[model samples]
Target chain A: MLSRVLYVDIGKRSSWVVDKHDIFSKYLGGSGVASKLLLEEARPGIDPFSPEAPIIFSPGYLVGVFPCMVKAVAMFKSPLTKNLGESHAGGHFSSALRFAGYGALVVRGASEYPVAVKIKDDKVRVEMADSLWGLSPLDVERSLRESHYEGMQSVISCGKAGERLVCYSNVIVDRYHHFGRLGLGAVFGSKRLKAISILGTGEIPLESPLAVKEMYEKLNHEVVLSGKMSKYHDLGTSANMLELNELGALPTHNFKDSRFKGAEGISGEVMAESLLRRKISCPGCPIACIHLAGLRTDFAPEHEKGKKEVFSEEVLLPYNYEPMYALGSNLLLSEAKNLLRLIYHCEFLGLDAMMVGNILAWTTEAFEEGRITLDDTLIKPEWGSVEAYLQIINNIVDMKSPFYAKLAQGLLETSKRYGGREYAMIAGNNGMAGYITGYGSIVGALVGARHSHLSNSGYSIDQKTMNQPLSHEQISDFLIEQEDWLYALYSLGACYFCRGVYTKEAVCEALKTVGTEKTKEELMKMGKEIFHNLYKFKVREGFELAEQEPPKRVYQVQTPHGMLKAEEVKAIIKLYIKKREGEGLRLKPEEKALKELLR
Target chain B: MKKALRFHIDVLHPERCIGCYSCVYACSRHLFNTIDPSRVAVFVRLNGTIANPFSVIACRFCKSPECAFACPTKALQPLPEGGITLIASRCEGCKTFDCISACAIEALALDRRTKLPIICDRCGDCAKYCPHNIFRYEEMK
Candidate 1:
């Protein structure tokens, strides 16, 4: 009975709930339902920042009911990629939304002034939030938490970057987690929306309690007692640092070198031994993968009567593989403390760490190449200079000058203007993730829906091929197969980290317990169809495969599998295109209605 | 005859809590056959920092429970296991909810639909499912 879809019009300051039984029953939920809604709600070729563009939040069917099913999917037209903007985050959001008795929430239209949307179960209120207009993401969360449900509700807010409409800005979820990729925060800013707070105390009845308990215990036992997930709980994905570095697959210094010599300095082992504080989890997840680092920051001395002159405060910041790679080796920053400070600034400003690292790296290289001088950049950009990077982050958020304004648009566009398209290290106008592994990685990223590493994990495929070689055809087939199945798992709201546990069989069994029955073959087919549907939206929004070529920098590097040429990557992507659609891309909208498609 | 050994769930290591809320969900699933926070007897909340980040609220199982004494409808009664038990039929769904205020630990919650007090029955489900060993089920002295 997960059929409720809540629509809130920010411009009209009104809300309504609609029964989307056909959507839920046919498409399942999460990204599947989100895709359908996006096509229906957003007008074709409309500007992403337009008030009419919709921000759809859909928590999959399994969310709030199963262990590790903690993610909620955010679907919007990305201001960054200017195509389909999709991101998933884990926190209290999915559970809160589920218990609020809705399968999905769509926010449409823009407001004239800054406001916050607060939903306590069915009661939705759009209130003026002028006081929270210029706050950082962390400060906004703190302010909303204190004023709302006494820190019990889930809150998502944008930083100054988002408010300023930085194309690469992100939305922080419940302080630690985020709708990190694309530019959902920019969308929030475009609507003049400040924050969203949700609290739910409603009940969802279990159809067969004993059956659910049996299935739950089985999965929970596999998750906790198996010791397979110990790596995730122990050091989190930060553990990948040493492994990827050893394999020489780690992207360092703008993909100049495949391995970082200072990898050990910022590896998870060192972080855990020296700076690790406490680990927390999203609701219902036993794996506490969110690792916090405690850094003692000193303030300038303040002289006062009977008071201490200098003060120090401990700041707890979350760290993960992507940011560690992006801010650490990618910038030649070796020290954990220095990297943490830069990451803290980026998180505080609400910028995507991967894009920020890519942009700064490109800027440094561009500075050295004399493509842009001190006139364009007020301060000289250098490698491993934390102060310079911090100032640059602030400048980008503040939109300090015309050059910075272009840089804030993302490195792809900035490089286009500043004359360094070759080494921009971007695919599809989105910055490259920290994986310069090989052909599968670059080709998969170039053609993947969001141009994200997580979209297909092509880097992982490349790593596996180090021992067993995968031909260009094999790699293409593997990426398409993996991407398609992943769409199905995502629609189920499984956290990316927990994908190993929620295998196709486990997914089938879990759904059965909830009175949802889908055969294994049907699930796989659903995955393929969902991926096609996503690509359909992307292509409709002017995404052309011919334009998304792997950057020249990727060709210059020596990966673990040795040198990768552009031809091999192009061949792989071309093969992927052929296999994904047979001959040409499907541009024509289906003559049949969506309900008929379900039939 | 010797009285049966009484057991109660206790917070043994609050420092180890990852704030997963497995216990809260487990309590709800075991008692109500649903995923309902309003019907659960345990609650966990984020405190917004690395140092002492999460606060866990669960029944302390008082011997002479003030909640039972404050119950005007006689819905709450002291159990031998050192916690209060709710007789849902006897609950009048009153407006005041004096029992909720009487509990000093703030462990008591009312069902949004039924308005009956949600009290721990000493089932130890919360302790059994806790991944970090934050809760413990032990015999009361």
Candidate 2:
């Protein structure tokens, strides 16, 4: 069946539908399909906040029916990185949307005034949202529920941060889950689009009912039997804090050291014991790995005073491993209660918590080194002080102070303005994540994505290749293969949690059900083609991987194993450049052969 | 007495449902021949906000049978045991969403390939799919 694409022009107050059968067949939906749309619609050198910038929401093929890990991809031109930007989030929203029958929604042109779009099973309507324009995501969701009391509907909207056009503003889906990177929310705000509400009742078709039944039974049994799946099912992503801390790979004091002494305070075990309330899963997921943490506000009084009052005196914040490490240990925050408060603030404010933590860490290091005075900056970093962190978060979202305005622009921009590229923890203009696991292959992956760890999670490299380090050339080649594979998974619209289950064979089987006649080998080749295409896009946009360099502090910092040298990291970069060249060469030959044959 | 065909199905209490697809998977275990819940007959949709929770959306087993009344080819028909049923052989692959529009509770869906209407036949298979007891099957009073 051909997937239908819905197009909305908020500026002209127009709505239309297109059945892009060719695009869906080739891209196979989700991010792959959305990227094709983005490349076609978004012009080079156009301001990300302009009407020309497109906001796209595309669901993976398995969304409405697949068990667990149905993520909706929100793609836009990023104001923060000023490059191709996409963020994936899982919630009830995407599945509901898919159930509603459209494969994707492309929103173009700004609304002349603030408005909201409501879609209810073949019925699409746009309503005035001037009253909701400046409302936080939480409020907008509440108002939507009160006004539109249709059968289970999900909403994706922005907060004050997006309305203010904060460079790192994220679009919040279902209040908690977010298209949480690259300022996609700001693009929505620029378009004066307040929210998108979808309630779908249409059903997707299954090819063979008997085959689907057998597949589910076998897959369910495998999931239950797998030890790896067990760990994730128990702790979710929060399982990494203690493990990374033990490896001395935890980013602490803003990357000054690889380990945090207070890691125990916020470890997964600690969170499980103190804060974990219940396990929540997205869409059709059976693992139910997400642990929604219950906050205990009264437990820590010292951390609760002053500017941190916005958080419920008794609150429950979702605790994940990376945010804890980034906003907690990385910022020298020791109290779990306080760390929870900081995380909550970031979510409510619609800021990318990882980038916010990275920028704050840089500011702290600069402050300690006397690069900036207290008068020059608004936030003061005291180890484990949640109140201080809250103050800083407010400043950034509001852009109330000069320091925060620059900080809100993100690490790369801040560093460039303040002369601190040596300490800035960013790659491809995006802030680095919390996984410090391997021989910096993860870092290389981050660089490759124009700065997204998920683009090529190097954690596996750190896990398997830790004992025997690879040469720079080998590392680069390995990363290219990993990156291509990861891109394929993303393109397939498959969740990373099922990376183990969706093996090459599984992927091929899934594709066969979708009517694609390609073998696993052919699918992989297509993935390679997509990877090279992304690289070409980056190059066309003036990214020089050969000249790309990691922050100096990465090399200087001492891990539990030892310190890495600049030359060692440079060799890795050289290897990456060579691999890229090889991929480029293969593409050229394929194109030439096709041309010659045609002639 | 006419022999009543027992079609396995489940009943959902929306208040008890957390919007999770556990039951959806349990139903997919029987229906789609794959783990993909999208193909399953039983699925959950949100009736409200995250704070308000979700509304259970599936076959409601209406007595008046709007879907059967709306079926152009009698593909959807009333069962002797009560509720509606789908006759695969009688279906003519019509894309007409008459049954879908006629469904007040929005339960009926057309199969992707055959374009035949699908209806809940109350066989009580999905009752086991719900771990939280949101779905239950009992002899009508």
Per-prediction DockQ comes to 0.54, 0.21
lDDT tens digits, residues A296-382, model 1?
786654543334434667878899999999889999999999999998998888889888988889989999999988888889899
Residue-pair clashes per candidate, as listed? 0, 28
Give the clash count for model 2.
28
True contacts kept of each: 0.63, 0.28
What does DockQ come to for candidate 1? 0.54
As for candidate 1, its clashing pairs are none
lDDT tens digits, residue span B1-141, model 1:
023227767887888888788888888998799987667888775565323567788888888999999989888888775677778788885678999989887788877667778767677878878899998887777
Q: Model 1: residues >4 Å from true position, as ranges?
A: A146-152, A303-310, A583-599, B1-5, B48-52
Q: Report the lDDT of model 1 for residue B116.
A: 78
| lDDT tens digits by residue: candidate 2, A104-123 | 89998888889999888788
lDDT: which candidate is best?
1
Per-residue error for A87 in candidate 2, Å, reads 1.0
**Cα lDDT for residue B75, candidate 1:** 86
Candidate with best DockQ: 1
